[model samples]
Structure formats: C-alpha cells, structure tokens
Target chain A: MIPFRFSYHKPSSLSEAFEILSEDGAVPMLGGTDLVVKMRAKRVTPKVVVDLKFIDELHNVSFSEDEGLVIGAAVTMNELIEDFAVVKERFPVFYQAIKKVGAYQTRNRATVAGNIANSSPAADSVPPLLTYNAKVKVVSADGERLVELKDFFTGPGRNVLKPGEIIHSIIVPYESPSIGMYYKISRIKAVDLSTIGVALTIIDPDGKRDIRVALASVAPTPVRAFKAEDYIRDKELSASSVERFAELVQESTSPITDARGSKEYRWEMAKVLPKRILRELGLFEGVA
Target chain B: MTITLNVNGKNVQVDVQPNETLLDVLRNKLYITGPKEGCGNGECGACTILYNGKVVNSCLVLALEADGAEILTIEGLTKDGRLHPIQEAFIEENAFQCGFCTPGFVISTKALLDRNPNPSNEDIIEALAGNLCRCTGYQTILKAVKRAAEKLGVEK
Candidate 1:
C-alpha cells in the first residue's frame, strides 16, 4: 500500500535535517525499515519526511578506549553484529537477540536507533540497551541533551523526546570488567517482535558489584527491576540466591496479556531466564 | 527532485517522488527490474538490493533515501553478461525451483561472500533466513551457497 501523501526532503547535512525536523510535526527518517511500513499502514502520517540517509554522521560507528562505544542512529544491526568487540567481548547474549530480530534481510535494513526511537514495549533492543545502562543523545532546535536509556521512554510507543527533537546516537558506557546476557521470547523463531525481552549485566569493579536487570513487555516500558536487585545484593552470587531474586522480579512486574504471550507466561519466563543467566556467570550455585 | 545515483557501476539520474519506495523507483522509473516485489513491506527479501555496500530491503527504503548512494542489483552482478560465480553456482546446482526467490537469494549470498569469504553452514543459513523458498526445501540452496563461497576461493 502506498503511504499517505507527504513531501520528502533529502538533507545533505545534519543541520539541514534538523531545520526540517524543527518544523511542526516534521519527521526525520533513517533506514526507514520500520517507519515506511508503519506509514503505509496509516500508523503515522506527516506533512514532510526529512531523509537523513545522506547525512554521513548519522550512520557512523566508532570505538574508543576512554569514552566507550558510540553508535550512530542509522547504524544497521548487521553492522553491529560484525563488530568483534560486540560479539566477542563476553556479550554473546546480545548476538543471540540481535540474531533473532526479523531475518537476515531485516537486520540488514533495521537500524538500532530506529528500534529504540520507536519505543514499542516489545522492541528487542530496549531491554538490552536498558540493561547496559546506555545513554541516548538527542538533538533538537533548542539544544542537545543526554538522557539515560531508562528514562528515554515514558510508556509504550511513547518517549520523552519532544517535537522537533531527534535521537542522534546511543552510548554504551565503557567498562573493562563487564558481563552481559540478553534473551528474548517470541512465538515464532523469525521476524516476530519479542513477547518479553531481558538483558542482564553484572559488573564487578573494585570489589563493588553492580547488577542490572532490564526487561521489556513486562510493564508500560522496558524497565529495570530495582526491587529484585535489592533482594540479591551482598549475597554471595549463587544459584539459589539468583532463583530467589528471579522470583522477586516476577512478583515486581505487572505483565499483561497481549497477542504475543499471556501475562502469566511472561511472568514465568521472566523468573526462569534471569536465574539461569546468573548461574551461567557463576552468580548462582544450585545448578549441578 | 533529480538525484544522482550509481547503479550497476554506471552513474544515472532519475526523477523521484518523495513517498515512493526505492523498489518502486528502481523497477518502474529507472527500469531496473531484477529486484522483484514480493511483499511491498520489508517482510520478504524479494526487493533486496545493496545500498552503499550494505544489503537492505529496497521496499522499506525510500527512493530519496538512496540518493547519491551506490546500488547493486541482480543485474549488476555480472559484467558484460558474464555470469558471476555465485550466479553460475545457483544455476548449476539448480538451487531454486520456482525462481521468484532465487534473485534475492543470489544477491544476499553475494553480500555474504563479499563480507565473509569463508562463512560456515550456519552463517549461510542465517544470511538467507529472510528469503523464503517453498520449492528448494533449503538443502540444495545451502549447498549452492557453500559452492559459491568455495568458488570464491575460501576454505570451508
């Protein structure tokens, strides 16, 4: 189906793109792997579309020793998978989730930024990004600001980003001793959005342990289960303890029954997976 | 608007509408029909094409999104009607039965080979996951991809 009538502007530079976005309800598009289809379905229609494909800066992927990993808004999932650091730096969990999003064809077209900006409760990337305690760098006609990934989304398909503001990049904070695990539950193995997604990361720095559990499709937004973390802290990271914590996480969440999965099933998986992950990282002891 | 795009190693100019998908412009306005339209949305890989050296579903990308970009379709794989090694491997192996999905498979396989000259059977499976074919049952198609990679001079 053809999208609703709209004017398209291909901006050569980000400044030009910003100027366009500043217009009332003007939208900036990158990759368009999701937005175009959404538009065709009448989910969203705008007076104009500011195409950011020509803006080279928006598609950049950079690595640094001091600052950390910075991915541009237009960086595709296929490019992210090719990164040696992302795949090999003890983050195999992410590779698993990224591998499950759509198919090889969709990954080649889907942008990490687009997934985040869409802010769907079921987006596979959000839980992981939230688990990493990632940061979103947004730009607008007013100025630029960095919002913690957890704070970026206010509710399902809703975000704090105001009109004329665009997400510029996402930052995964640099940490030397970090272990991350990600998992997603879907009805079919291919191309379906997550029914519930979870990203678990534990970092032991200077003998201070920071465990982050971020999940999606469990609440109005992908959120961190702080109450669950509080229950397990200072306990010798063990299987039984992890199990106890997982149960607490299930209790804390208000999962709903949607087309993807029932509220009860989401709660059960939410409890089961995190404990299993904690065990894999030697944070649990009950497993043989 | 008039946009300059490089297609099949030749620089071409075309008039584009703002809302039209790249697949529409490539198949209709520019007349490069190698990329077929299976699902106008990105669910199917039939309209897959290379945009700036990265494989993308053309149907999901707007025509203006591809301006000043380098594009390669099934038509661009061979030079002067010479069959690309992958192309030959597809025909020789009879990798496809219905042939509608063959072009997308061949193009996506080309992308895999270009990036990783030595991909495992698992890699081949993942790369072709988005392209569906009811005819081949995937065994022959998988072998054909491995054959192309071998022809590209990669071990395993």
Candidate 2:
C-alpha cells in the first residue's frame, strides 16, 4: 500500500481531466503501472491522482492511408497486438518492441503513451517509435500540439510536457514496403529492462535503401543514429561499409556504466549488435 | 471512497482509500487471500487476478479504479467444494513446492486456457512469463498445464 494519502478522480472527458490536472499536485495517470509503483516508493507524492482511462477520446485507434496510424493514449499493449493486425503487418518493429515491454500482465495495463511519458532511456517502445518517426499529440486545456518523437524527451525521466498537458495519441506516418525489427539485450529473456536496444528499418521504396537506426539504453534518452544514417544513405550495405556504419552508430552513444552493463560493453555492443542485427534482418549483403 | 465490485460472482460494497491497491483490499479488507503479495511492485505476479476478464497484477491497480468491475481470484476457481480441474491437475502433477506462487500461476494458466484452450508450449511460456516460481518447479507446473488441457478435452 502507498504510504501517502491522495484523492482519486476519474474524469469522463478531456476537459474534466484538464481541469483537475490544472490544480497543484494533480497528476494524470494513464495505466499506473509505473506511476503507482513510484507512488508506493514515495518517489512521487501527489495530492490528487487523476485517472484518464475513462475519457472516451483517449480510447481511439484508427489508421488510414492519408492519416497514417493514430493510437490513443489509453490503448494498452495487449489491445494494440490483439485488436489490430495492421500494427504487426505494417509496423513489425513497433509490435515486437511492445511485446517486449514488461510481461503479459503488465502489458495488459501498460500503454504506449505511458511508456513514452515515463521517459526512461531503456523503454522498449521508444527505439522502435523513434525509427518509425512517430509523433506525440499533446493536448492541453487551452489547445493541442504535435511534437516529434525524437525531440520529445528532455532527459532521463523528463519530457516537454507542461502542467495540464497530456498526450492524446501517437501518430505514425504510413510507410510502405518497409520491414524492420527491434533487437534488445536484457538481463533475462523477459520482464527486464533492455541493457541495449537497437531498432533498424530499411525502407526500400524504388530501390532506395533508406536505413533508419535508433537505439535505447546507451544515452540519457533513446536517440537516432543520424550520422550513421547519413553515412549509409543510398549506399550498398557491404560487409566493410556495414562495419563502418556500426562504428558510426557506436560513436553516437555516450553511455555510463550501470548495474545492467558497463559503458565499455555498451559501446562495444552498440557497434557489434547493429551489424549482427542487420545480417539477421537480411539487410546485409555478401558475408558479415 | 465507497466502491462496488463484483468479486467471485458476488456484488460487494467496500470503503477504500484512493491510494490503496486492489490487492490490499482483496487480501486485507475483504479477507480474500487467494491473491498473495510476493512483491509490492509488479515484478512478481503473485497477485495476478482477472480484472474484467483480463489477467493483471492487482497490486498495480488502484482499488478505486476497480469499482464496478468484475473480478475473479483463485478462490473463484473452485466450484461448491470441489477443486478446479487446473487445481486437480496441479496436485496430480505436484506442480508446486512451497505453494506461495501457486494461486498466481493457476490464475494465469486459467486465463491462458480460457482464451486459447489448446495452447502451444510457446503460448504457455509467454502467458506465464510474469509469474516467477522461487521453488523452480516449472517442469511439473508445465506438465500440470498440459494435463489440465488434456482434462479439458484438448489433446496435448
């Protein structure tokens, strides 16, 4: 049980949630898989806990060719996997990453928005979302705005969200003929944070091998390997060039030694995993 | 806060604090001890229960959020006084050692069987990944799940 006293409010509408969140010490809770644990540990003590799952607008998951994919803030990982086949067919990397978030019971309550909102560097969903170039739809009592997923995180456990502002949904632009995967090294097979995560997507539309690489657990936040992407743009992914690309990807990281892994080990894997993963994804050509 | 919950097919009203977890209410207030508290956080699945027909950790769920929702714990698995088929299979297979994590494993297995009915070994592994057995008696537990599946009329 939590060691503090807090009032709970379940708002039926966004306006109500905004009104409650505008007050001092009022916090919006999506799934509470992370927040409730923090509260129990006394890391976060709020006077009012506003539950946002009751809002009808936050339960939407709609996709279209024009609008791409729009997943609401309250959509759980299980709902995304079971109810929507499009996610697996179109965004396999995102689907696989979501499956690796915690375990089955936690996934039943965990939301993608909550995962992003937590702003953890080891969050499984961020690397895949970053590779997909997802956008965060932020809503406030005054209005709403869209922020790029790459620029969303400010630091560890920090984001651009202001008071009274909540994420409405995540928007993923539709890309065709693209296949990608998220490979993570965790302490165990499941239920542990990723020691290092790499998401690689090769968009080969009209033979343009536009490879996008994003990584987690190597920095303060999940980041895209822009230098590597620039180096490998439209070039044939040969063994030597892929090795160089892997080195550039490793150059982009500024990791620290923690309990999960050493900084040197992360730097090494940051270089090694990309090539192996590239080969595993069948993007590498002519021997590793 | 006063909330009404349909627990084990019975509608009951209880007063709970907003900060209190559903696991605390089930084990402390209502005295339903089926869901154990191995870890206060969700790392261990000792408090697994069916919330609105989906398996979730009760410790992570607020008691207030569970208001008016249907809940099923391990106690609900028994009919009259007879043990559930899953429970019988567990005993027959000696699926547990110390038995602290039995309730959660049973609930997770039931959730899996209810949905899949004939689950593959991969399916069972995925479903029970949240639950951890300190006794390390997973082989027999797996056998029990398969045995329960057999008893439910699905061949292996």
* lDDT agreement with native, every candidate: 0.80, 0.91
| Tens-digit lDDT string for candidate 1 (B1-156) | 888889989999998888888889899988999888987777768888888887788888777767788999999989778998899899889899989888888888999998888899988887887787878888988989988988888433
In model 2, the Cα lDDT at residue A286 comes to: 42
Chain A: TM-score in each candidate? 0.91, 0.97
Decoy 2 TM-score against native = 0.98
Report the CAPRI category for model 2.
high
Model 2 clashes, total count: 0
lDDT of model 2 at residue B136? 57
lDDT of 1 by residue, A1-288 (tens): 355778888787778887888777688777686788889888889788887766888877776756667888877787787754554463444556677788877887777788888888877877766766679999876789999988889888899988878889988776656676777777766667788888887766236677778887888888788888788777776556777888887776789998988998888888987877776766565642
Candidate 2's displacement at residue A266, Å, is: 0.9
lDDT leader: 2
Docking class of 1: medium
RMSD of 1: 2.8
